[model samples]
Target: MSGRLSMCTICPGENEQIDAVIKIGRERRSVIYGTVIDENRDPVADAVVKLLQVCDNGRIIPLTHTFTDKYGQFLLGPLCPNQKYMLKIYKDNITIRYDPIDAECSDGDCIGNKCKRHDSGCK
Candidate 1:
């Protein structure tokens, strides 16, 4: 009768009282976390990572952004499962755009590479 009810319906009755409870299950969200490295495979700290969502009408919506830590590690999360997203990394006056990444709902981490070719190694 409390705590995140998905749906509730009540019916009238004559001289009668009743209590009904409805429950719904929640799906797990997706998270994208990875490290950003340079051509020499060195961690690129202070890099800007942007997560974008592209609409069918060719409109790009910026979902979230994060900066890499000293170890060039970044995390962007709680995203919708089974959805596609674009990752844009910026560092040292250079921009790297990766292809659309399909986010899956799982506990496993999604590791990607940030190289000169912008190959994210995401499927």
Candidate 2:
């Protein structure tokens, strides 16, 4: 927990001051980030990016989705680190599904993107 009192006791406003409290806790979440580009490495703006989770029984579940920006960049996450996920990109009437990407990492409380693409937007 964390917080602050705006005024000191010597301050006139402190006499009738209300109260405030703040609680802080760690949120275990991670992100998946990437960019969409064509064979020539040109950005594919407004491209659709889908996130899917595969169950142990071979069932595929649709998680969330986003679209690439003008720089072909997209971000999706705050996902569980123990799960496996795959990315699907759609643009120009074509869909490309990437292989399963493990959300796990070296840190037990791991978070952030494990896969990344280099582009102007990423910088």
Candidate 3:
């Protein structure tokens, strides 16, 4: 009893809560990850993945953008937790059809906590 040792194993107590517990943030992150595919389901490298912010009244604003890797895989964010966003793909008309993800959805996952919300391209 000399040394203080405590095992704080945080389990959701069931399978359903696994994802819930893992994503323990005030605002659950909007993590959008996928491969840029062409019409034939082939990986397209250097494709653009655009993340646009939506206004309170459902207005689309221009946000930052990124390019997919050689594997056609791209990581949109570590974006604002529990925030709404519009994700789009460019350079080949790659329409992104994924649910918005944020920065708080993992117990030990490494994601940026920075609020990279740019005020540019706002109308």
User: Which number leads on TM-score?
Assistant: 2
Residue pairs with backbone atoms closer than 3 Å in model 1 (clashes) = none
Task: Provide TM-scores for the models.
Answer: 0.52, 0.54, 0.49
Give the CA lDDT, 0 to 100, for residue 77 in model 3: 66
Candidate 1, after superposition: displacement of residue 62 in Å? Answer: 0.9
Per-residue lDDT for 1-123 in model 2, tens only?
A: 122224434443745865656454565667877888999999999998999998888889999899999999998876787888888888886689989975533323225746443343321
Local accuracy of candidate 1 as per-residue lDDT tens digits, 1-119? 12332566688689987876656776467778899999999999999999998777888899989999999999887787667789999988768998998786333444694335444
Pairwise lDDT winner, candidates 1 and 2: 1
Overall local distance difference test of candidate 3 = 0.71
Alpha-carbon error at 9 in model 3, in Å?
24
Could you arrange the candidates by lDDT from highest to lowest?
1, 2, 3
Ranking of predictions according to TM-score: 2, 1, 3
The CA-based lDDT of model 1 is what? 0.80
User: How much is the lDDT of residue 15 in candidate 2?
Assistant: 53
Residue 55 in candidate 3, Cα distance off native in Å: 1.8
The sequence of per-residue lDDT tens digits that candidate 3 reaches over residues 1-123 is 112223456556555545433333253445678898888988989888999988889889977889999989987666776568987888655587888765443234236764455544444
Instruction: Name model 3 segments beyond 4 Å from true.
Output: 1-27, 92-123
Clashes of each: 0, 1, 8
Best by lDDT: 1
